[model samples]
Target chain A: MGKKITIEPVTRVEGHGKVTIHLDNDNNFERSRLHIVEFRGFEKFIQGRPYWEAPVTVQRLCGICPVSHHLAAAKAMDVIVGAGTGDGLTPTGEKMRRLMHYGQVFQSHVLHFFHLASPDLLFGIDGDPAIRNVIGIAKMHKDLAVQAVMMRKYGQEIIKVTAGKKIHGTGAIPGGINKHLSLKEKMSLLDGKDPMNADKMIEWSLGGLEFFKNFHKANKDLIDNFAAFPSKHLSLVRKDGALDLYHGVIRAIDADGKKILNDVDSQDYLEHIAEEVKSWSYMKFPYLRKYGPKDGWYRVGPLSRMNTAEFIPSPLAQKEFEIFKAYTNGKPNHSSMHYHWARLIEILHCAEMMKDLLNDPDLMEGELVTKGTKSYEGVGLLEAPRGTLFHHYRINKDDQITMANLIVSTTNNNMPMNLAVESATKQFISGQDKITEGMLNAVEVSIRAYDPCLSCATHAIGKLPLQVKLYDSKNNLIDKRTKD
Target chain B: MEKKQKILFYGYGNIGRQDDGVGVVFSEQLSKWVEDNNLQNIDFDSNYQLNIEDAENIKNYDIVFFVDASTKESVNNFDISSIEPNSDVSFTMHAVSPGFILNICSEIGEHQPKSFLVQIKGYEWEFQQPLTAKTENNLQKTLIFFKKYLKKLLIEKKIEEIDLKSLLKIKND
Candidate 1:
């Protein structure tokens, strides 16, 4: 009989997800799907609320990337308040927000690469499960472990400084920010004691790149070929085509590096992209409107951002970006494992940006807010650490939000993740008579490449425990395994 | 007079999620009480959840209390248990266990703080809802017990010397 294998609460990625693989009686792989079990009702929940509360209210959606939601909502409201999309803010306003964003991307990517992705790279997919985690990394590579923890701390410190608190930060408001960076705060972050300062962060970021490059050089086959596939890429880029995580025009390119969607105003995202609902998953798959559901699917996040941008604005990261692009001969990289390389490069860029922002005098002085004529509808788009994020809203005359839609980064990468699972299954589990832990891990490693935050995608939670079940074509259970 | 040992009460949970906020609320309430009572050698911090960097935060203190909400059936109104270093890897970094944080501290810091988990039983976890009546009552009981127990630890004995069993016997329930 044919067999079906299910891996529940796929391990080491944010939030809960399940992978199901089907095979013929001969144990040859047939197909696979990644099911998102939770349902997110944040849009309906925010319908009756005042529009001004959207930024803070939306944060209740996900703890993993609340800042992304916070800023995205704020940007949408910026348009609602006629703040000219993203550029109308005061020097202090825009700079502070950028600082906060770089901090978020810096910390988020660091966590993904070091805490989540490094284990799979350091210990092969078949390494002892007992020692295949950050804890294991700490036991063996103490220095790297310490650096990851410290780098996370530094990014969080930046968040705390800019957002005004650890949780439910209200720093970014419509029209502009509420406060400016204090001189003391600037000095503390810019020239803090050993290891906490921006200089040290830049140094460590370079070291991180070196570490990944060394690993890549030694394990080129695994790094370059694992789950490699072709797909279109999308992200927001600066007017001049530099990588801009904060604000820019939406751009997407094909698998062969041709612009399918030219640089366009984010306000018209609906005209360019659409989300398709699938019966199997709660999350929606987003695709380019022109290509339709069948072929419009595109990749997002760090690797996509690398492919879409023409260059890195910062000096150090720009150098690394050239090497990354040249490796593929300036073509878009389709290898899922290369996401780590792209993420590490962004980390270095963020560090350099932070150093420059810290030295800028405007962060400490200038107008804090701007007022303008109001509008009822707005759309906000930004490149989140994982990928491109969209926040759209329409409010009534009473300033109550009548409609709200959020297409989170994870949701945008839905199709890609499913494809990755399918690819890994073909490579590792095809023709296997029995499912092993290593085989299951191979499937997970592919999804982990995108660092999908299912919490943000589903915007919901459930009983998340790890388990795998095997069943015969008759739907009779054959084997089962679970882990806490 | 001997120098007073530094103590930290770190609570973590998502405040937006009704009863799930109990841990953060506990810390916030305790922070006010500490200020009002002019308490010394005590500090409080709260966040949506605990992360790896908390290992660095706890190393400076002599006693660490990790407050959290629990859904386990065995937990009564509230429960206090000792925490030992655990390096078992979790499926995600969205949040890590207190024991895991302690383990990281032991690995990197000079000395691990004496740590315990104060688990307040919570009932509801709906979004944007207030704490259910039953959970609020449990929280109050846990808070009252902690206030008294902390005073006793300060005035009567060294925190490291306090018996963990005594805490289990004195559950607010």
Candidate 2:
């Protein structure tokens, strides 16, 4: 029997998780696995609820990215409504929904980059944990911190204006949004008069891109090869192969950036994908149908979205995307650290897209919602901030939900994340009992790159506590650690 | 002229959990109370959990009261005590303790707010379970105590004289 090293509740990321590293008798690495400990039975609980309430109900799954669930559920309900009315949302309705969804993407990405990821990138991952936080960033670079807060506030404001609240907003409904953007609210965001105006947000996003570029240039090895591995990439893209977060066909690309699957409808998710469960963890591993469990594991989120999209429609974002691609020699950049870079670029795109949507005259002339024919089954898909999120539901004749299945982004990236943890552990951990905080942080960084939401991915319900244990060849615990 | 201290009532817990939501529910009531009484320089907010970002939020406030549910039955209906920022930060971003948030605030902000954790006794944590009668009674008692204590501080403008331990001892009896 070999020794084991574990790091529980990987810090600065959302939810609860633990990492276990196995070492042989000679103190050499054997294997490692990241376990999600939280359990949420959102799918089962919503069974008796009305179909229209799914949007509001599922939002409780994640406080950080509730809008993603909100919109995904609404889209699923839209399918149900479409069955009865012979159509889905009206043109105005769809446009408004897209606007709200972009706001969510913008806010979530901003929060991740500034609040969660930047603390690590700005302050070295090995820096003092006491000061390696948002506060530290504020102290070190006041201007950057101020700008980050402004940018996040701007994104949150967009969400508030569209969804009616910053976190658990109730804007999206069965067929469409309940309200349209008022002129005053729209102008407040776009006009330069406000502290967090659209111009400043765009400028800050571009500056963020440059900052990341310089950081990557300085830490080339860490940026390019840290947890770097080949895997499949998945995201949603417009029919013409443009980046589309709100509505589009699901696309899958190979490790080498070659398109393997294209234009798969969200409704047909089961036919193409299946979930494999492991007895050790609460999360379910989802992989492509063709490759089976072991080889079918794919990556999703910002890195995946950037790898699969043909071009970003927004001008500044497209320019940055070109630079991003050039860095990879026109190939998909497999470096996990680039997730931060791709995230900043997406934030730029989201900001620009928000401006474009706000300027469109149709956004102001919407009838808010469209009454659709009721359907028994529906599925909704969209690019959540973390990755592609799918919501599937089956309803009875009485309009109560009969069954619900949610494939969150974290679940889709489960296999890749485990691979990342294993790779980092093998590369960093040297001795059986010589485990350093830096070694643990290296593993944490790999998982943070994915921004996994364990609270939303798990199906069980209870308190999730994380513990890291180190064992000797005799399988006796030599060192044990926990975060409380 | 002495500056009127800006106060923040921050209540955080998961509302979906039965009595674990007492802090949030209490904050809601306090917000309405503040508005009804037209208390100036007072702010209120609640969420499912606290995060590292909340450090920046508390920077400008002069005083902050962090209200959360405590499962300890031996304690008083609610306990109030001063809290200092600790260097330890949680591994997860989903939830953070008030002391840690304070530590971050003190580390980054130009000023550190005088803070206290108002822990109310909670009995249940089941999903979708309503607040227990005991929790409700405790919540009412805590709210009544805060209403008087805050009025005194706000009217007298003597934040320094507001003794947290004395208040706890008095409320315990």
Alpha-carbon TM-score of each model against the true structure: 0.97, 0.92
Q: What's the true lDDT of residue A189 in model 1?
A: 89
Clashes of each: 2, 5
Which lDDT tens digits does candidate 1 get at residues A266-335? Answer: 9999999999999999999998999999999999999999999999999999999999999999999999
- Candidate 1: misplaced stretches above 4 Å? B1-5, B169-173
Can you write out model 2's per-residue Cα lDDT over A318-392, one digit (the tens) per residue? 999999899878888898988999999999999898888888777778577877567799999999989999999
Worst 10 residues of 2 chain A by lDDT: A83-92
lDDT of each: 0.90, 0.81
Clashing pairs in 2: A11-B91, A39-A460, A84-A373, A84-A374, A85-A373
lDDT of 1 by residue, B1-173 (tens): 23435888998888889888898989999899989989888999888888888887888888899999899999899888999999767787776899999998888765688899989999888778678889889999988898888787778766777557867665533
Candidate 2 lDDT score at position A305: 91
